[model samples]
Target: MYLLELYQNNYSKDLVLFETLEEGREFVAQIPGYTLETEDGFDVEYVNPKYLPDYMEIVFNGNIVPLSRFSFNSEENVDIIWKEISNLSVKNDKVIEGYSKIDAYVVNNDEVKAYVEAREANYRKAKDFIERCGYEADRSFFGSEDGEAILYRKCGAEDWHFLCHLDPLFVEIEDVEEYVKEALEEAF
Candidate 1:
């Protein structure tokens, strides 16, 4: 049994149980962008952050130039098209020369850069929390049945805290308190 914790955002958390680690990895791959936990030794298609605008071409005096070569400085000889209150035109040297705007077509598409960044940050926080708490999947027998458990404990603590049962069947015991005490005594 495997326990998978997914952090979709900073405020939301989802826990999933899988019989095998492979199943968990397969589920994580279905998500679009790369996550912090998914990057660790997982065989998934990691997506690189792609910038928007298929291509930015600026037309100046019948000459088209890429965005890289276009200058927005005040000293440049250019009249940037602006659609302000009515139509406005600003000439070089910070002067508003005319009251006419440029006719242009705009595409309102969603940007994924910020979303990807927030997702990755949330995943990183989840990973850090797991590490700080020393939580991990471990095989242990509850009562007489063998199963996997997600356990955690305070740093330098001798007792193991049971987080959740990864197995589908919820194995119960008469006294969970005695079990931890017995386990600790045996370890010492």
Candidate 2:
């Protein structure tokens, strides 16, 4: 995928995101005067801080001069055109920016029951609380049939999970008594 960035006489901006260079070249050929360029992929953030690309244009005489580029018929007109191009924009793949594992945490069905039974409401708060207590509570994907997914990473093991699934919301824990125990010994 490529970003077909439009420019008119080195002034103005517009973006026509395309899935391939051929698509971009087609758009350029149709609008004679408008110069097209490529930009690196953008992040998934929809509200991009970058300036909007150059506006649309039409080729004037054989050698076009002076920047009298075209404008959208109306805001609706712009919206309609953007509606077509926006989806074509290359969005960054979902990424796990960072990762942390709860190797030293504990989980008991009774203790984390506060989360499991009424799982919906308390999940967020409980998850946040667990993270603040210095452990990533996870249960589901990495879980086993005999047990819920409580991620207890072995000391110095290379099997750390992606930060996305390493959070407390997806897992359960119990033992309300010793929440975030200090100086708990770890077994590799």
Could you estimate the TM-score for every candidate? Answer: 0.19, 0.20
- 95 Cα displacement, candidate 2 (Å): 43
Instruction: Give me the overall lDDT of model 1.
Output: 0.37
Candidate 2 per-residue C-alpha lDDT over 1-188 given as tens digits, one digit per residue, 9 for 90 to 100 = 45544322333344645566565555545542333333476311111112223453434334332222233221111111221232324464543222222322344433444434444333454445556555565555544323333343334555643222323543443432243232123322
Candidate 1 wrongly placed segments (more than 4 Å): 8-12, 35-188
lDDT per residue for candidate 1 within 26-90, as digits (tens), equals 65444333233334675333222232134455443354534321122223222111122211342
Which residue pairs clash in candidate 1? 87-99, 87-100
Please tell me which predicted candidate would have the highest TM-score against the true structure: 2
